[model samples]
Structures are given as structure tokens and as C-alpha cells.
Target: MSSDSTKPEEYLSKINEVRTLLGPLPEKSSEFCSDAAIARYLAARNGHVKKATKMLKETLKWRTQYKPEEIRWEEIAREAETGKIYRANYTDKYGRTVLVMRPSSQNTKSYKGQIRFLVYCMENAILNLSDSQEQMVWLIDFHGFNMSHISVKVSRETAHVLQEHYPERLGAAILYNPPKIFEPFYKMVKPFLEPKTCNKVKFVYSDDNLSKKVLEDLFDMEQLEVEFGGKNSDAGFSFEKYAERMREDDLKFFGNTTVTSASALLTNSDSEVSDSENKHLEDKEDEKIKNGTLESSLDTLEKPKPEA
Candidate 1:
């Protein structure tokens, strides 16, 4: 016998090990019976058949061996053409195995649609992508929750037929003035003002009403004015200019440029008048006391002369 040839006893031992781990593989469900299941089955048999703790742990370890770092999008396209299925392992942010399925497709539409759909489906569930070639595959076997349970198989022919009826929506377009960019600015400043006051908050770039709504919900009106310009002028103020203005003055007292200046002038004038009036009143009081003392001294001198 060749040195590499396995003895009958060794072969039997390996088979027994497999049988020991998994209760006999279910005869009816080949699709559902996975390697992890076999490991769990054996672990369960070794202990009380009712308790699955050991089996579950061993199965988890087996599943973790193939965890991948990142998912690739390109390989998923190729697998779709061959009509062969591919599976890969991926890990999520929480460190769970993410098993991904790669569906085979013959056409571009079939492949792209599947890829896009899979990405959308896994957005909330999976942590990272593992591989991408003919078909995009991810590893998601963590905690024995099969992501494929929710997946719907898209055949190539069906994909082609659907692609004809419904043209795919293009990827979101980049805008010079996207509503999202202005949303934060609006939101940060809208709450400080009433609805009537907010109407004055002009939308410079886009007409999207959603942008306006976002601004209304998140921003204080006073803060929003600073974003537009320190003062409403013909030339809009840059952010740096606005910052400089804020640094130079107290923002709380400086709501409107015209009103703030006017208030400061009025306050100074009122303070000066108050000080002058106080001085005049003090001088009059001093004069009255001097007159009273003089009258008392004259009265005392007259009384002494009369006695002499």
C-alpha cells in the first residue's frame, strides 16, 4: 500500500468523529444542514443532548476562522455571469460572522441591480464587505443568524426582464449647492425665531423645500444671521469676517448692527445726564447747610452782647 493511503480504521475514526459532533445529518434538509450545524450536533451529543452550549461554542469558533476584513464590489459582477453561487465570510462592527451570497448573472443590469440591492439590504446589518469579483459576497455567520434567510434569489432571466420594465435609478447626483450642506446651518439657527421671522432667512443656493424644513427645525434665527453675514449688506460676509466681528464685540448685545449702535449711544447720553444732575443736587445741599450754620453763630453772638 502507498504510504499516503489512509488505513480503513483511520477513515472510520474520522467518520465517527463527524457523527459524534452532529446528530446524524438531517435527511430532509441538505440546504439547511451546514458544517457549523454538524459541529454543534457533535458537541450536543457529547454532553446532555438537550443542552446545546458546547455545540454552539464549537460552531461559533469554526465560523470565526474565515472572518474577512473588507468586502469587494468588483468580483461580485463576475460571479453573476457564470450561474454559479459563491459564499464568503465577513465580520461586522460588533465582530459577528456575516455570510454573504454571490448570485451569478449573465448581463450588466442583472449584476448591477443585485449588487445595489444587496448593499441596501445589508446596510444596517453587516459591518464590512469581504470579497467582490463576479458576485459580491460578505461573511455574516456571526451568532448563527443567517442573513440569507431574508434574501430573495434573483435569477438572471428574471433580472433581465425586470431591468427592461424598470430602468435603474442613477446614483445620487452631486450638487454645487446640495440641500444637505445648508441643512445644518439652517437647523442650527431656526429655533430662535418665530415662523414669520424665519421667512426672512433667505435660501441662496437651492429651491428644495426640504432644505428649508431642515433649517427651520435645527437652527436659531440669531445664529443663522451670522452665517449669512454679520449685517445684511449688499456684499455677503464670509465666515471668517463673521468670526472677526463676533470676536470684537459681545454677541449677546449685538443682535442687529443698527440697533446695537443706537442703544450704546443712548445709554452713554443717559449716564452722563444722570451724573450731572447728581453733582448739581450735592452742591445745593452743601450751600443750604452753610447758610444754617451762619444763622446759628449770629444768634449766639447777639445773646452774649445782651448779657454783657
Candidate 2:
């Protein structure tokens, strides 16, 4: 950690310092980089400019290659069919978006597809966030979970993608009703969780009133899903409806721009955007990041840059 102080002017100075260190970004790279985004990276790294720069650069590269923003709901619709994960219709007490995940609902065998769906959920959650909130809440139900559900590879990758690319975006992760047998699996995944992230994870059980109180403090029972002991009994996840919601959000995010859809465009089947037109749209998207209107974050500073 470079400094414990969090004074505003100083924080802005750090953002500028990181930008200077990063020098000029590639044309496509600036699409999501902003002062607020840089501040998140700095905060995650505890106010270190050099470390934040390196971390932010790596993320920029990942975003370019992975193109998380380009992944539309139509592409990952299959992975989400089982309702393994979806953005909850409700928000937490602080108005943060809530992402409901049920491991027992896993229906896919493709790890690659599973990861893509996770990223899609994450991006949707962020897109729906209010200007006042930068983080989202994760409500993971462990009902019917067993050893067969555990995948060490998926666990590590989840931790890496969230921590490395999303930086400080998790307000809290409620591991609700995990089985006693889940302890060993959790232990295996613990090493991949950074100390800061690990501290944000809460293990809540239905039998433990004190532990369950954590939920009461953070959520409205009426809005939370019934699986988590909440009042919402409409637990059914309709793939058609959820896909419709995601498509709506995607349209809002991309506006009239050409979206990279695996299936035909849901909004307008009659029209198609050409490659040159798509580039123009991307150029406009880059301007939004320069204007610092988009909400996104990255990594931090303090540690020495690793030897090349």
C-alpha cells in the first residue's frame, strides 16, 4: 500500500499520475478507461500509481482480446438456460444490483461457456448500477450442492477474472446455505481469493440466526429470492423473459450501434450494420470513456513491478 490517506485532490492526482505512466492508450483501449475507473484501481491497490498502471494495462489488454462488452445475451443464452446465474430483479438495501447464482442449477458441461455467462452477468450488473453505486452484490445459493459440483479450475478462474478485471466491484458475496461438505472445497478456492476479496465473503446459514441477520441488514426479504429464505416465492427463471431483459439492456448499452450478436439482431431484424459503420460506433464509444461517463474499474499500486 502506498498511502492510507484518501483525500480527494490527492486521489485525483494519483489518477493523473497513472495515466501519465500508462502514456497514450491504443485507440480501442480508451473506451472504458476513465478517472473514476482509475480511482478504483488505485483504491484496490491502496493508492499505488505504478502498480495501478500495470494492473490497468493488463486489464486493457484483456478487455481488447476478450471483448466482454461485445458478448451479447443471444450468445450466452444457452449457458443461462438452467438459471444457474442471472441478475436479480431487485437491488440491495444500498441499491446495488444483486446477482443470484445457484450452483446446483448448473446445467452446462462447457467451462468456457460458463465463464462467458459469468462475464455477461457481471457486465449487466454494472450497466444497471446507479451513479451512486459502483459495486454489486452476489447471492450464491448452495442448496442441493455437493462435492460433484466443485470444480477447482472454475473456482480459480472466477476469482482471477473478477479480481483482476473487475477490481473492487463486489460489495459482498453471500454464500447462503452452503453444505457442511462444502468446507473442503471452499478451502481449496480460498488461496485464489485476495485478502480484501476474501474478507467481503459472508457465509450465511438458515439454521444460524446471527449469521442470517447479515442478510436482513443488507436485503429486503420481500425482494430477495425465496431460496435464500426471502419472501419472493416467484423463483422460476424463464429463459425467454431473462433473455428479453438482457437484450433490452444490451440495446441500451450499445444504443444504435452495431452489437456483436451470435444470433440475428433481436431489436431490428431488417437492418444490419456494416464493418465500417461498426468502427464508427466504436470510435464514438471511445469518446464516452474519454468523457469519463462510463462506469468501470481496474487495479492498484504499491508492489514492485515483476522482472520481465
Candidate 3:
């Protein structure tokens, strides 16, 4: 093997040593990219490029344990700006179909490039959903990738746009392995959503146990019956199972429940408070302008009488 090829293998051995000490990596791994790209990312992090390549290659080799049946790239197609279609095919896992799209040679910017590539694939695949099944759910898993720098409001807006465009046909679930250590921004804006639409939204941690903790903190289990119209008997399900059901059902059953009603009211009240504060500030400014004008007029009247 060439020196370049051998370097990546050397790096892989080092990564394996670290993993052995730390314990096995997470079940889901990062998506595949070129060795050069992987090397660049490693170099940026002061990591050994060869070791990263070796580790990544080992990970890829381990992925074959899942026995993903290879499908033709031509099975899935996307329309070009010139009105032509490009085709690709991905295998099905459980009930979900998975596609792996390689990024263009020009786009070698690492993390950002991967994200952009994934988004592009999702959009193109979404356009072809009509050709597939009607009641399809798209689960885009981002494994431990940090997107904390992206504005939550902007993310929410993008989600809303996707939801509106696809309606029942489209739903996105982000799985952050090792989990992103960021505050829950989705919770703040969730109330702004209509109850009917809110059913479609889910912000979940990859860890089921952590997700359970989040639910307990944010929502009352006993209130699920009174608030969401779900029977208390439903508590028998595991947190992960329950979340899956919620995503699938689109929160339709939750409509007209006490919790949804309360959430809507709270959202309205928050908006009203913001509006009131803004109005009060404007009134103060207007009053100051009027007082200044009055003072100027008084001075003119008092001083000009002698001249007249």
C-alpha cells in the first residue's frame, strides 16, 4: 500500500486503543465521507489523520454486521435545475429506507458540508415521496454532531416550513448521540404552535432515559388523561415507544385536551405581555416629545411679548 493509505491505518490503531480504554463507541455512528475529508477534520482537532481514517474504516467494516442489502443508486432519482432527474437507491432498515449520498468533490468543508449534503438529499427525496408511500415518516439522524451554533428559532422555522409543505407526509426527528449540551429552545417556541400542529413536533434526546426525564420535568403524567385525552392506562408503554407513537399519531388525539388548551392560552398571554411592554415604551417616548414642545412654546411666549 502507498504511504498515504498506510497512514490512515496507523491512525485507526491509535483510535482503537482509545476506544478500548473508554469503552465501545455508540451504536449509531457518523455518516461516511472521503478519507481526505476525514483527515482534514482530524487535523483541525489536532487529531492524527491516519488514525481517524483507520478508525473510520473499521467503523465502516463493522457496519456490514447490520447486513444492509445494497440497492441501486438509480432506484431513487432527483430533478435537476435543467429538468433532468438523477437516480439513487437505499436499503430499508426496520421499516425505514436509508440512502447514502456522497458529497461532490468540490464540497470538502467537513461538518457544514455534510449537513448541506444531507439537507439536499432530504429535499430531493421528499419531492419523490409521491412516487413511494403516502403515509411516510422521514427520520434524519444526526449522530453527536453539534448544531448548537445554529439558531433554534431558525431551526424551528425551517421545521415549520417543511411541515407545512409536506403536511402529514413529512416529519423529522434529530437524534444527537452523546447528546448536545444545549438548553431546550424548542420548548420555549413549542407553545406558539397550534395544538393540531404541535402534535407534529418533537424535540427528543437520543437517550431514552434522558427523554423520560425531560418529559417528566416538562409534562405531568397524570395530566396526560385530562390534558391530552389519552388514557392513564397508556403509561404502560416505555418512553421511547410512547414517543414513537406520539410522532406517528401527529398529536391529533391530544387536541381538545386540557394541556393543549392551557399551552395555547399561555402562548397568547406571553404575546400580549410583549405587546403591552412595547406600547408602554412608545407612550413614554411620545409624552417626552410633547413635554419638550410645550416647554419651547412657553419660552417663546414669555420672551417675545416685549418685542411685540
Candidate 4:
């Protein structure tokens, strides 16, 4: 593989240091313990080996606890059906995966469910990555999203998960056509994000982002939907179709096992974790978000399956 300018020779040293800190990962976690994986932690820590090692161990423990990769599409189907969040078929000019979210389609009743849904999308995005790309960009379509959709706890937890467990994976996050009311909620969520991560967020007014640099220069118009200035905007994308594709991919990934196991939550007895621990989940908490009633909104949402 060609050298990544963001990762330098010292990255290997940092990786080794963190590896020494965490000890050997399980055979299945080979991907999680690679040189490049450790390099990402180093970058997240600004090359400080000790800090990087600490962060690495914490994230690895979280990974063992969370097992985000193992979450089945079945558990997230209801949220995905809303089409509020999804992995777009196209990549940006730099090959980073593109994720689209419609804040108005917040139909799920549970906060952990929503976070898990987004995590499912993010994990699927990584699974769909080409060898060259390691990051992603989020495009939050704020159209029709009123104040009711904002939740401080959900926002804080989402940002925490991204900054903590999934460090160094966000290439950029662009909020498109945010209404004026979004500012207050956005401000509340800003403090939770890392300074490095906060810098990657961009707010674009429709009038401004309609310019060539966004749709034309940063992305190939033909690869995207026309709503986002791509050719496929008119081509209706269905949750059923996308989920079917994901299921097929999963079949190949799991060697025909349709249902996968849910990740076991953290306990004191886990091998790597038992050595010591800084923190653990207190309890499964739900954020109280008052999303507006879905009246005419169903017209825009995808029905994952006919309710019984």
C-alpha cells in the first residue's frame, strides 16, 4: 500500500506501544489491532504514545463491549425504514463514504435505538469502503426539521460515541439547509465534540451550497442524487432495496449465517477488561426527544415492512 501522508514512520512506533499496552487481541479482532488501526489512535491523540495507548485500550474495550460490527440489520430495520439515516451509494471526490440523514424523519421511540441505528449505518459505511478510504462525511438534511427533533442527550451521546469509540473516522460533516431554530441545539451539542472533530463540521445554506464547489467540485454530479446535485435524485431509492443488498452482502460476509449474535455488554470478567478499568456503563439510558408527530411525514418515509 502507498504511504499515507497523515500517518508517518513514528505511527508504527506508537502502534507498537499501544499494542504492548493492550496486549494481544483475539484472533477475530485482527483488523482492530493492525498497524493502521493503532495509527488512527495516534492521530486522534496527536502522536502522544501514552495518551494514544490509553485511548486505544479504551476503544478496544468499548469495541469488545459494543461489537458495533456485529449488530444485525434486523435490530435496526425500523429506524432504517424511516430513511432518516443511510449510507449513500456514492462516494465523494476523495473517496470518503457519504451518509445522509433527514432530521425530520426521527420516528424511532428510543434513544439507544437511534444511536444504534446510526452506528449500524456507520459500520456498514466502513464495510463498504474501498481500500483507499478510511473516513466518511455526513450530510444532515435539515429541511422540515423543526425544534421538536432536537435532543441534547442523544446529540451528546452520538458525538461522544463518534469521538470516543470511533475516533479518526469522520472526514467531514456538512449540515445542509439548517433552519434558524437549529442553532440553539447545534450550540448545545458543540461542546461535546473534540476540537479537531468540531473543525470538520460545516453549515451550508441552500443558496450558498448550491454553488459549483459543493455539488460540482467536491462530488461527481452523476454519482449523486440531484437533490444533492447528482443525477440520481429522481431515481427512487427504497429501504427494502438497500436492506436487501445489505443482507446479500451479509450472507457473503458471514458464510450464510443470516442472524448474527448481539454483542455482550461489558462486565468485570472480560479478559482484557478484567486487568483493570476506568469506567463502565451505569445503565441503559434513554434520551427524551420530542419529535413532532408523524402526520404527513410518512409520505416521505420508507415503509420497511407492512406492520402486522
Maximum-TM-score candidate: 2
- Writing each residue's lDDT as its tens digit, candidate 4 over 239-289 gives 889789777766766556244544324221342253223122211111122
Model 2 clash pairs are: 41-299, 48-301, 52-300
Model 2, span 74-173: residue lDDT tens: 6677778888999988899999889888999888655556677798899889889998777888989888887556443455467678877898788889
Tell me the tens digit of each residue's lDDT in model 3 across 41-129. 24322465344445445544534442111211111111121111111222222222222211121222122222222333444454344
Model 2 residue runs over 4 Å out of place are 1-10, 256-308
Task: Name the runs in model 4 displaced over 4 angstroms.
Answer: 1-5, 8-10, 209-212, 234-236, 262-308
lDDT of each: 0.29, 0.72, 0.32, 0.66
Clashing pairs in 3: 11-50, 11-51, 12-51, 73-88, 73-89, 76-88, 227-259
Worst 10 residues of 4 by lDDT: 278-287
Lowest summed lDDT across 10 adjacent residues in model 3 is found at 299-308
**Better model by TM-score: candidate 1 vs candidate 3:** 3
lDDT order, best first, reads 2, 4, 3, 1
